[model samples]
Target: MGQPVMVKPTFEKLIPTIGSSFRCFDRTGLNLPSRWHRHPEIELTYVDRGTGTRLVGDNIDSYRDHDLVLIGSDLPHTWQSDQYLGRKYDRHSAIVIQFHPDFLGEQFFELPEFEAISMMLTSARRGLWFPAEVGEQIGAVMTRMTIEPPVLRLIHLLEVLSELSSCPSAEPLSSQGFAPSLTSASETRTEKVCHYISQHFRNPNLSHEELASHACMNPSAFSRFFKQSTGKTLTEYLNELRIGLACRLLMDSDMSILDVSLEAGFANVSYFNRRFRESRGMTPREYRRRYTEATETSNT
Candidate 1:
């Protein structure tokens, strides 16, 4: 969702330093790397600063400062910064930690002392997201690990994991029915179609015929292939992307509802309102109000 880029998720190979079984990176740049990639290692990522779209497995959403998420082994993911937001900082900041599931030892997490964390790892197979406040609380520890000695970093890593494992409010990002297709490499045609959709979804005149032509398939065949590869119909996928963008606009700007609807590619205001309520369980105004109130309270 970040770039007009879509492809079979490339497998990334990571090598840990000589003394550590895990790797940590504290990165700052104009934007985070927006690769649709996967790896054998599980990942914990905290966005110390930035606003952007987050794609994990089959889930897509907007993320803001203090964002935190855990990606299970081999889950495809990337974060793309919105060029329009937070330009004053001229940089995006994040800390990433990656480790094998058995980084500690084959049976380390199997012990009673790690019962909760073990359960958490299992749940992270679908991707786990913690509240922004959780990120704020643990960000300093993660930041320190960037420069701490190996043994000290390992201690802090466990402390961070222990705290996260005890958080009851962490939410799963991907749906229960969603599954990553490691075999996606063989689906180049589907990837091309997806890439095109990502770029043109905001075009109100976008049509199935046009997309099918881009994929060089009949509309009927394209529909079947897209559904099989992504577990979502074209309309369903487009709506989700638009809704995500709408939510971001609601939170980041004072755009009127009609303006937000049009900017997000909806042709009609009524339809946008209906779909927004269905997805958010509230009107756009309500969603904006709630987010604003929560942000103000946090600031206070």
Candidate 2:
């Protein structure tokens, strides 16, 4: 699991209360805002084509074509398109289904037939992902469910849900410990701070004063506000951003450890090694070697 980040998600209702039944959307290569957000409805999504980062309540990972995910209500999520932040023609189109937990009324869970689905929904509180084989088996039915005639569509949906409830290849994405809430003014401000850091962490000029200026607060006040909101000092957060980048480099590239350290904004190799060990419990070299070996084995 990726390190859990409990930031507030942008709050909004996914579907307008028009029809009594749930809604399905078949969008083809349309650009959607990747800003983090949440709603009260549970969501099931299948990406037929795309490549990008998907942030689902701390389960940060890259997503490619055929990615299928089911997120419980109020869990924050957004998929950033690798094509371009706003470009629609390159990649990313999906079949999405969204509904309130009580779309069939609260009494639906009382049925004996729905017992397994009830447990599955409960497990989705942490977010669930069906495997590729499950996706292949069910993806077509899901896409068609959105546009099929009402009565038949509902039956297909039930069938899909039953399949999901028992699919052995399923797994949870985000950690159970990640319980985020609605967005607030304070949270919005911190999000801006985080955005600023993510964009400029490599700059040597990045400091508490620089960050405070972006936040429109004086140095001392911003320090306290940031610590309170994120539970980490600005310095620690900066290091986290740098370390995360370093980890990505270690996994994907052939850069030397010293070069990776400098590229990740550390002044020297020794300090980077110390911090890497403290955060990762191993030196950068070992991390790269182990990760590479594991990846090679998996691919073979």
Task: Name the top TM-score candidate.
Answer: 1
| lDDT of candidate 1 over 1-300, digit per residue (tens) | 233454544677899988888999876663633566778899999998877778787788888889999999977777766654335434667899999999889999999999999999999988999998899998878998999999999999998999999999999987888764567543456556665765677777788898888887899988887776666788887888788889988998999999989888888989999999998899999999999999999899
- C-alpha lDDT of residue 36 in model 2: 61
How do the predictions measure up, each by TM-score? 0.87, 0.69
Q: Which 10-residue window of candidate 2 scores lowest in summed lDDT?
A: 1-10
What's the CA error at residue 136 for candidate 2, in Å?
A: 3.5
Candidate 1 lands at a TM-score of: 0.87
**Which pairs of residues clash in candidate 1, taking residues 3 or more apart in a chain or in different chains?**
none
Best by lDDT: 1
| Stretches > 4 Å off in candidate 2 | 1-9, 16-20, 27-33, 83-90, 181-183, 190-212, 217-300
Report the CA-based lDDT of candidate 1 relative to the real structure.
0.82
What is the overall TM-score of model 2 with all chains considered together?
0.69
